[model samples]
Each structure stands twice: as structure tokens, then as C-alpha cells.
Target: MKPNLSLRVSQHLALTPQLQQSIRLLQLSTLELAQEVEQMLDENPFLELSSDDGAPEPDPQAPADATYSEATNADQISAGDENDVETPAVDTPDDWEGDGSMDAAVEDGEWGGDGTVRSGSGADEDEADAADLARSHESLTDYLHRQALSLRLSELDRAALRFLIESLNDDGYLEDTLESLAVGLAGADDAEQLDELVHRFTVALGLLQSLEPTGVGARDLAECLTLQLHAMNLHEEGDPAVVEAALRICRQPLDLLAKRDLRRLSQLCATGEEDTRQAMALIARLEPRPGRRFADVERNAIVPDVIVRKTGRGAQQSFSVQLNPDVMPRLRVHDIYASALRGGRGGEGHQALQARLQEARWFIKNIQQRFDTILRVSRAIVERQKNFFVHGELAMRPMVLREIADELGLHESTISRVTTAKYMATPQGTFELKYFFGSGLGTETGGNASSTAVRALIKQFVAAEDARKPLSDNQIAEMLKEQGIECARRTVAKYREALKIAPANLRKAL
Candidate 1:
């Protein structure tokens, strides 16, 4: 049977190019969004950065409802205008007589002035400098090379040392064995040359270990600790008996030290219980990671997208939620260019330029929508978790993406996009927007307790636990049961691990 074509009418959802861009922009973190804006500014001639003086003054006659009151800065775009691309009106060429260039228009105040974004204030600059210090930090290799310059060594010894220095991992561990390293350096299968290279590497390794970072060039955690212990012994930094015990303990299996098996460690190290305890404590004080300080810390830096401030007092207490001005990119359509494109006579390139103008408008509109959606979602979170704002994470209530999505008349996916990489600066601390949402646990009162709150409670119990008798996961679960929250031992253990807390056996002190 052959199929025949028939007239049909069907309706299905579709994503326009502008809608796709909006969705893409919504999911980006503040840093990513800034980079995207910079790229668009470079690619599209119609787009430019709005200067501080370029922002339009608020009209005294305009109704209060027309502007967004939550924003501290007047340049903030209103969230209400979803359909309009609120661009400043461009003047016709007849209105101003000049060279007809963007520079001339900016000087005459016909469009945004200078198109130069101002640098952040002094406090912001200081914070930025601190952040830059993390990004521009000296690496472990560079640090070692700087110290190497002072060493009075033969050229061959220096070459060997440099080769060894380059072989170190980020943790300052020499993962490859001396044999393998020598084989790599020898670049030949000759036994005599391989043996000579191995000897050279051994000498270089000894010289490298004696460098200032103390434990650099270690092959394993045990070796790293032993090196630090030796350094401490040389400096007379600790008790002789304790240092010796610690050195002995480092030689034994590390699992015993990790489990805090005081009896086993004392037996192995041939030291008294008190001396073993002191040794373990001393081991804990030593730096296991020689390259930790030099590791790039810039990856951990966070730039929050929203700011929440506490307002009023007592019964009138409230919180003001606003988009972070610092993270918002000041962008606008190049008014003179747009006006010229509109006023010019028809030509082959005119349509392409018009398309670019429309793109710029759509970009501005999409950017506004992105921030607007974030603000709405953030406000919804602040409203629901107000108790958390006042009383900390322990007071956080159970929440889900659907709740905010329903409240804002947006899809759950949109809510997820808004929360994913976006951060909020609150009275408690800066938290990712998704941090406010967590699964719930049932309570005896027929209510739900947020998993976040449960984790916070578990953290509190652990903090206040007796050092001699730390609480176990089972005990913690029982305590939660007594508090009317039904949490199992495994759940408590999972939360404890998520908080990076050690287990009871490991936490126990002598």
C-alpha cells in the first residue's frame, strides 16, 4: 500500500535562534557570561559597552512600578519588559551635524559617551589583586629553580637536578622510579650508560630533597613525612623521643596511622602509649603535601551573581534581593550605527547590516532576560528560605526546583539553568543557588526536614563530640531519631563524608 499526502495542521514547540541564545546565556556562570559578552562585542559592530555616564537618568515623572526597585544601580534593566528591547532612541543624521562617526556622536553626547567601562572601585581592585595573586602564583618548579640558582654545583650535577625537578608532579611526588627516569634520560639500551644515569639521578635526588620546601622530590606519602621528620629533628623542633617514635611510625604501614591505632602503632614503633600518641600528633602537624602552597588557587575562586541584604528590625525584618552589579555586563546597541543603518538608502550590504542590528537588539534583550530570570529565581529562594538567611543552614527547609518553577511560571529546566552556576551572596555566606535545594527526610511530626539541615545538624554533633569518645554514624542516627528525624546510619555516613569529616575511629584522640 502506497501512502498519499494530505493537508494537515499540527502545532509543536520550537526554539528560535534568540530563544536558544537566551537559554545558553542563562546557564552560563558569571565569568562565562562576561567572556561571552566580550566575544559578542568584538564580533558584532552594533554592540558596545555602556559607560558609567552613558546610562539614562531615571525619569522623575515615570511611575515607580516601571522601574526595578531591587537594584542598587540605576542602570539595571527592568524585568517586566519581556517583549521589548529597551534601547535608547537614536537621533537622525539631520538632528546633529558632525563627522557622522561614532566618536563624534559620543563626544557630542548623542549616544553613550566614550563607550569605556570604568574599572572597579578601590576595595574591588584590592579584592581583584588578591585574586590575581592566586592566578599569577609561582609554581613549585619555578620555586625550586629559584633556590637552585644559589647552589654551587658542577654543570653536570645542575643538569641532573634540573631534569629531576621537571619530573615532579603537582604534589611534589616523584611518581616514576629512578630506573625509569634514568632510562628516559639515557635514551639508549646500553647497560653502562643506564647505570651511570641512575647514579647521577640518585645524587640529584638527594640534592633536590635538601631544597627549602623540605619534602619536595619524595616518591610517596611515607617518604614525604620521613623527610619532614628528619628536618624537624635537625632543627630540634620537637622532643627527641617523640620525633624518633614518629620516624619509626612513618616507616610502618600508613593505614595504622590513618586509623589512629595507638596500640598497634606503639607496638610497631616500640614506644610507650603516651609517646606514640605524641608521635601521631606530630605526624599530623607535618605537611604531607609539599606543593600545596604553590598549587593554583584560582580554580576555587567564586564570583557570586546575586546579593541579598537584611533590612528592618524585629517583626518588620525583611531581606532585599538584588543582582550583583559587579557581575552584570553593561551592554547596549551602538545607537549611531543603528540609526545610520535605518536612515541609509537601500544597498546590497544594507540587509546584512540590518540583520546585525537586529542581532544586537536580540542579544541585549536575551541578556536582560537572563538576569531577570536569575533575579526572579533568587527572590523566590530568599522568600522560601528566609529562616535559613536569619538562622543559618540548620534552618534551611526542604525545597525543589519545581517549587520555584511553578511560582515563577517557568519550566523546571529553566529553573535548573538559573540555579546551576549562579551564586547568591547572603548574610550567612555566598552559596550556589542550587545549594538551597535538597531532598527531604521524613520527621515524626509528619513534616519534612531538609537534607541540608540534617547535614548541618550532623556537623554540629560532630563538632561538640568528646575527643576521647567520638560519635559513630549509628549513634548519630539514633540521636536524630530522638530529635524526631528518621535518618539511617548510611545516610548520616554519606552526609559526614560529603562534609569531608573523618569517621569516629579516625577522629578519636588519645
Candidate 2:
């Protein structure tokens, strides 16, 4: 076996560097893609952002009309790779335009037949600036510290309060017990020192809870609610009897309140049914998360990769999908650098510089391909789920990655990558691209109902149900059955939970 030698021929797929880059760029969210572009621009001398005025001036060192010579080279390189993985073509239909500008009329449900889509430029600009300003807001800790400055306290008390403020979680709840906090602070096993630290923490805790947001230093939900109730009582914000009843209810197990167990709450709070109901209602108005407003807005901000606008009216209704110009990076090969490289042939480090130029070209090509694929996929989604845009989530049709993948001559994994982390802005609201694809449930008409639509229906039923006697999952299921959808009670419950709706028992009013 050691001396054996034979000729063999085998074929296996391999992702080329450009192909890998294309795949990677396709999957990245708008923010991530922008970061990648920034990195490429920094590393490659040949790569630069294209001008808003259109193509750069023609390079004198190069042939006439060769301002974007690298673009042609890129096309040639990509075209010559016959055996490489299929990349989405940039040639799109006239209807499926990628020109960043959108028409104002399209948003008003009227297509002027120019095939152009434009949002309210002035309004969007102001809104974007406001959003950017909003995202730059201070963190919860910073906000608390700002309020702390107005306090007149000894250094020790101030330090303790600062420590407690920093210890609070994003939700404004102090997750650690004062004993543990004191132990951590004392950093010793001495009992007396620990007690002194705990006392300071307790004093600090009271002061911290009295902050502007209220309930900032609470250790648990009950404590947070109690603190807010006490504040309300002190301020005479609500009826005295109701506030007192709420305080009493907060002392009992929270599960009773969550379940809306009026009898149990009345028994535990020692209040009349009417008073308990009012107390529960009062508690509902209180903010459970005091620091939620201060949470980092930038982290949660979603920059959609595609924008879909409603076009036409009545019987001629249509959707115009376009790549979000804001998210798409305007990238190109540096004309001066590429011209210098082209003219100074066989110079020192010529090969390395040429490789970088090629890389820059590939980067631009891949970026173009990425947006093209996204546009294609988005158009397919809009075509299939057009009803969803017009009629909302209830009219969402059952769809899968394979359908779009097949229609676009792409692999299912590519479709998945396109959808993940990528969002689309539609009249219905911005949603992830994956939101359009959902598993189907069988219906009596031998058709399929999207699970998303089913979830939407469940939400509607819950919304419309009588508060005194909310519809149970079984009742929801029965209602769906009557509506030609064959959904199980468990499925309804699952969808309800997914929608974050409470159970019937919990949803019931006193």
C-alpha cells in the first residue's frame, strides 16, 4: 500500500477570495457592511468613496473614457471566472430600479410611471438628525450621576449612592442584595464593618430610590412597584385608598397580581373588590422599568437595507422596492492611484500594488453584487407578500427561503444570509427580511396559512375580546377553525406567547 501511486480526477466546490468576500458582504447588516467598507478603504490605497456628482474625471495617464477603467477590469475578471460560484447580475428590470432617489407620489400610493421612488427628503433628513441626537443620550449610570450632583450628602453617603447606582442593571433594578453589595464593598470578613457598610447602603438605597426616574435602586419587581406606589402616595397622585391598597398588594406574592387574581388580591390586601381593582389598575400605570428610556438607543437602532414604497391606487396598486441609499456605501477604485499603477508598469513593488488594485476592484464588484442580490430577493418578497404591505401582517402569505432562492437562481443558504440581520422599510413598518418568511399551517380550503398571519389573527382576537372574559387559547383555536384555519390550541398559545400576550386568566379584568 505504501508504494501505490495512481492518477485521480475529482471535482469539489471551492469559494474563491472574491466569492467569499461577496458572501460575507451579503450577510453583514448595514452597520457591519459600512464598517467593512471603511476598513477596506483604509487598507487599500486604490479604494475610495465615489463622488456624489457621479463618475470621477478621466485619468490622463489612462486611455480616453477610462475614468472607471478598474470597473471594466473588474467586469472582465468576474466574467472570465466561468467556473466560479454564480454571482447575482446587476442588470435589473426598469421597474426594479436601484437609483437611490424615490418619488414623493409613490409614498402617497400613486405611481407617476417614472419608475422612480423618493421619500420626503426634508422630513427624513430632520428625522434622521433627531434620531442621531436621541441616540447620543447619556447612559443610565450617567443620568443617575447627573441627578446625584444636586444632592447634599456627606462624601461617604455620596460614595455609597454612587456605588449603588453603578451596581444597578440596565432595567434600573439593583439585582444584588445589600448584604452582598456591602460584602463586596467591604472586601473583608469583619462583621461590624459589613454591618456599617450595609447601613450606609440602606441609607444610600433610599436616596437612590428617590431619584428623578423613581424606583432606580429596587432589588426586585415588588420593591420597585412599592417604591413607586409610596412616591405616588406621598405626592397624592392617586386616590389615597387606592394607593394604600396598591401598597398592600405589592407586599403579597407578585404572581397573584400577574394572574389578575382579584379574589386572592382582595383577600391578601384586605380590601374590597372595587378597591383592589382600582389598585391593580393604578399599578398598571406605574413604570416597571425606570431606566428603560436611558438604555443605549444606538445599539437598538435598525438601519434597513431596503425600502419598499406603495405605488398606484385601487386596482392598479403595486409596490416599488429599492435598496436604501443611506445604507449602500458609494465605493469605487481611486482613479489617480489606479492610473499611476497602470502607467508605472514593472516598478518596484508593482506586483503587490497591482494585487491591492485588483482587491479594490473586487471589493467594489462584490459590493455591487451584494446590493443587486438584496434587491432581487426583496423584489421577490414584495411580489409574494404584496398583500402583507397593503393589508398588514394578517395577509402575509406562507413563504420560505427556497422559494426566493429558486426564483432568483440562488442557493437557500444565500437567501438565509440575505435575510439575516437585514431589514426592509415598508409602509407597514421596518421589519427584518426574515419576517416575510414563515412556516405554513393547513387550512380547510386545502390552502396554507402563514404562521405569521395566524399570529396576527390571534393578536386581533385577543385585542377585540372582552376584557372581563378574555378569550382562552381554546376559544381562539375554535375561532380560527371557524375561519377556515386549522390551528391547535397549543399553537395558538405558542403564537400568543410569541406576541407577548398574557394568558386569558391573566388578561381578565376585575
**Candidate with the greatest lDDT versus the true structure:** 1
TM-score for each candidate, following the candidate numbering: 0.81, 0.82
lDDT of candidate model 1 versus the reference: 0.78
lDDT tens readout by residue for model 2, 1-510: 589888998755544565567677888888888789889889888777766653455444433432224344234222212222233223322442222111111121111111111111111434464258666799999999999999999999999999999999999999999999888877767999999999999999999999978888888999999999888878888799999999999999998888788988899778999999999999999999999999878777777877777767899887666666677666656777776676786966998897777677566656766766776677789888978999999899999988987787666888888899999989999999999999999999899999999999998898899998999999999999999999998999899999999898888876
In the range 210-304, model 1's lDDT, one tens digit per residue, is 99698999999999999999999899998999999999999999998888899998888789999999999999999999999888677677878
Question: Can you tell me which runs of candidate 1 are displaced by over 4 Å?
Answer: 1-3, 7-10, 56-139, 159-163, 177-200, 270-274, 343-348
Q: Give stretches of model 2 more than 4 Å off.
A: 51-54, 58-130, 136-139, 177-186, 189-200, 269-274, 343-348
Specify the poorest-scoring 10-residue window by lDDT in model 1: 99-108
lDDT of 2 at 495: 93
